[model samples]
Target: MASDGASNNERLLAAARDDNEDLLLDVFDQPGTFDINYQDGLGNTALHYAVLHTSYDVLDHILSHEECDVDPTNKLDKATPLHLAVEKEDPEDREYFVENLLEAGANYTIRNKHGETAEDLVKPGDEVILALFRKAQADADANMDDIAYEDDDDVASEGSD
Candidate 1:
């Protein structure tokens, strides 16, 4: 049973690393067979592998999982997948991943061992990535305001009773 679990984790990690979406989806579909956040020897989860390997398809599948932790950190560096995505050499790929990650609710404020948040890692003059981060922050702030307003209304209604 231990071997099975270990092998399943290896298979899942390999699928992410190789960008084999079909294999990844197959493994994920089997209930309780594999954890979505299964970490490798270096404590890098499947999400981290997807980002490092530039496997957007694998990433999308992982992000769609209800239990997915978008900001999972690698054990060795404490670097979240978002932090790794920011380090992509290709600007277009980097921007795409950043946008998708934010949309998938990746925490922009999560700092790595180096104390660098995803926003902090942005290269200077990269206005596009910076704008995407700002938009996510604005959206998050708006959501908090809405929640607070709803709570206030609920309190007032209870008081009126």
Candidate 2:
């Protein structure tokens, strides 16, 4: 049973790395076949492999899954998927992955082993990526503000009661 689980996890990682959506879907269909966030020997989850290999479709599928965690850190570098996205060699690919990851709730504030956040890895003079980070931060702040306001309203209503 343990080996079966390990095999399933390897298949999951391979599906993500190879961008094999069919294989991924098949794995998902099998009950108890794999844990969506199962980390390999390197502590790298399927999400991490998708980011490193630029498997956009697989990445999207993983991100959209309810079981998926957007910010899992690998053991070696303690790097999250967002960290890998920022380090993409191609400019366009970098933007696409960064945007998708951010939209899927990736936290840019998460620090790796080196204490460097995803935003810190952004190339100098790359205002486009910086703007995306700023926007995500602003959106998060707004969400907090909204939650606080709602809580305040609840408190006021309770006082009146």
- Each prediction's Cα RMSD? 2.7, 2.7
Whole-model lDDT values for every prediction = 0.87, 0.89
lDDT of 1 at 117: 96
**Model 2 lDDT tens row, 73-137:** 99999999999999999988899999999999998989999999999999999888999999999
Error of 2 at 25 (Å): 0.7
> Considering only N, C-alpha and C atoms within 3 Å, which residue pairs clash in candidate 2?
none
Query: For candidate 1, what is the lDDT?
Result: 0.87
| TM-score, one value per model | 0.93, 0.93
Model 2 Cα shift for residue 38 (angstroms): 0.5
